[model samples]
Target: MSTTGHHAAHKVVVIGGGYAGTLAANRLRTRPDIGVTLVNPRPEFVDRIRLHQFAAGTGQATADYGTLLGDGVRLVVDSAERIDTAARTVRLASGRALGYDYVVYAVGSTCAIPASVPGAAEFAVPIAELEPARRLRARLRELPPDAPITVVGGGLTGVETAAELAGQGRGVTLVCGHTLAPSLSAPGRRSLATWLSRHGVVVLEAAAVNEVRPDAVVFADGVVRASALTIWAAGFGVPRLAAASGLRTDALGRLLTDETLTSVDDDHVVAAGDAAAPSGRPLRMSCYAAGPLGARAADTVLSRIAGTAPAVIDLAFTGSCVSLGRRAGLRQFARKDDTATNVYFDGRMGAMYKELTCKVALWKIRREARRPGSMIWIKGGPRPGQPVADGARDDHGARDARC
Candidate 1:
């Protein structure tokens, strides 16, 4: 690949159009020295964290990447088939080749559906992507008015889905393999359970799903009769793009990256979002981490292009929010070090807070798209302190004061 009449410097290519890749591309557009191109299969960036909301009959879930991208950034709507790190070039699915001086792999993650579960492949719907979520929502609406709905996996997605379905006057049963929100504190989990029960969701904790059928789910204890609508939100698995490209990856196929989110043993490649595993640390797959990691990855790329060592990437969580339908939610606070903090908000107010958080996440991305590097203000605060940071604290205080 030759630049021809173009500039004769370094070229950067970023894979994926999700939160991480979009942010990284926008940030890179700020620099005039480097030529940047973003390669993704989709023309639009889907709000993945809100996929459940879309499935549960909420707002639209897709955003135009063209609107989000900056003027100088080139958009390549194609999948990366192969990456020759030694040759410093990438082969796309469209048979075109792109040579890059630096590459950022933010392809995101996919749902790992177990093959052992019968009928799961045919019937179970995974809300990991926008299209699937939209299809699931359409199927759910077509079901009988009073049909029984079963949601497998008691994690955040399952709980939220169950709550939303139940809120729509459908009988929902949330089957938890072990516990609901295992990352949450004990009190937070209990509050989640209570809220689900209150929302008419029959939560069965510690009930492992042995198999899924078209009209029923077989658990370890017994079988739960259900309708045609079965949702699977068990776990996340990264795509094999990294492994296929001959890069270093984990057992789950996530590209192993150093502290600065650069690919190990390959400084020319970097990764962010769910497709990246930071060396020596376990970070949960959430949009919270994706947004920050995206920015950090961009910073690293820019620093390296500027002939400087990239800064070390560090992510600290503030809190986690789970919405139980549109009426109730739980906000779990965490310490500055990302440890669980004994603070939470429940009931209607909590639901409002959760909605606000979703809006803010999308807003932050859109704001950055409109004005690159504007989200650096978020780093000034003390790791965002979860639900107790400024507005959240005041809201909690006001609720407590009223109580």
Candidate 2:
């Protein structure tokens, strides 16, 4: 008989259904002794990385969780209002209470447009979530042709949105607070710049947007430009449930975890995805790190249940893939720590590669959904006594802190 067959089913509740939460829940199914419950705000899975594509109307962002989650896991469609670590229960906004032996916090993140910026919260549309993407799509449909559409921030999200809209023939300007794709290599930026120019996107460098008016963006230097539609993709931010629940958060409300991905305050609680900060060192907010973190979180629970010590987290990133319209893209290579390397795959080849990369990411999720514990990530170097590094933190934590 299997080890799982001899034990009572352990109830594991995973909050949030983004990349990390889904992966962790599905992976937990590997142990038949575990009864996994996945709680999500939406019934369907949102491919957050492709929200720009969804905004551009190139593809849909949602998938039925029924087909994406493992059969061994129960799906609860509701918002988690509070987590009671002492009782190992999660209270849902719908007045449902869920009991669990282990709780995985993975509520993901959102765009970091500051409410302090005048008119920003009211005027700018962020493509981080489904509703905002739908609103942006609706706005795009209503706007007149040849209207100026301004995309704020020069990060990957802004670049992709600008490129996608520019390809659709909307007059587009990208307001880069400092530099364009600062994380990209020189060649990578050159290729991106070429693509943007080909798509007729005006690049604004070092223009800090101080205020967002109804019809324009005012820069810190008092320069104002007309904008028919303003898309805010500046940064990412997390939710506040961890802090509200009295969990120890690192100023930004991310659940603080030890190197083993176990919550510092509660042994029954663990976190993955954008809501996790491991040993004060978080992974990037991107799916590049979230997928692996989800799998690692499951391993911790599995190891603990099997009477072995859980392995420490060792996440290493290889590169970043950004799509510049459907025809162009950049696969900027990076060091294991996620800093840019001189090497890259660019242009048409890069686009094809990025397409493949995205397919693979979804494939990973689906594959695990069908066969839990099948998806895994590259293991880092030998675990050091003091493993956390300041520079190697996840991007999500950085975005959360800004919010």
TM, every model: 0.89, 0.93
Question: Could you give candidate 1's per-residue lDDT for residues 1-403 as a string of tens digits?
Answer: 1123136377888898887788887777567677778888987778776677788776567877756777667888899998889999999999999999999899888776778888787889987777788889899778886788888776777777788788778888887777666656789888887777776888777787777888888876676666567888776678898989999898778888887898896998988877877673435667777778788888888888787998766555576787777778888887645456778888898889888877777677777767777755234323222222222211011111000
lDDT for 60 in candidate 2 is 78
- List CA RMSD, all candidates: 6.3, 3.7
Residue 168 displacement (Å), model 1: 0.8
**399 in model 1: Cα distance from truth in Å?**
28
Compared with the true structure, model 2 gives a TM-score of 0.93
Lowest-lDDT window of 10 residues in candidate 1? 394-403
C-alpha lDDT (0 to 100) for residue 272 of candidate 2: 92
Model 2, global lDDT: 0.79
lDDT of 2 by residue, 2-30 (tens): 11211347888899998889989889888
Task: Quote the positional error of residue 65 for candidate 2 in Å.
Answer: 1.1
The alpha-carbon root-mean-square deviation between model 1 and the true structure, to one decimal in Å, is: 6.3
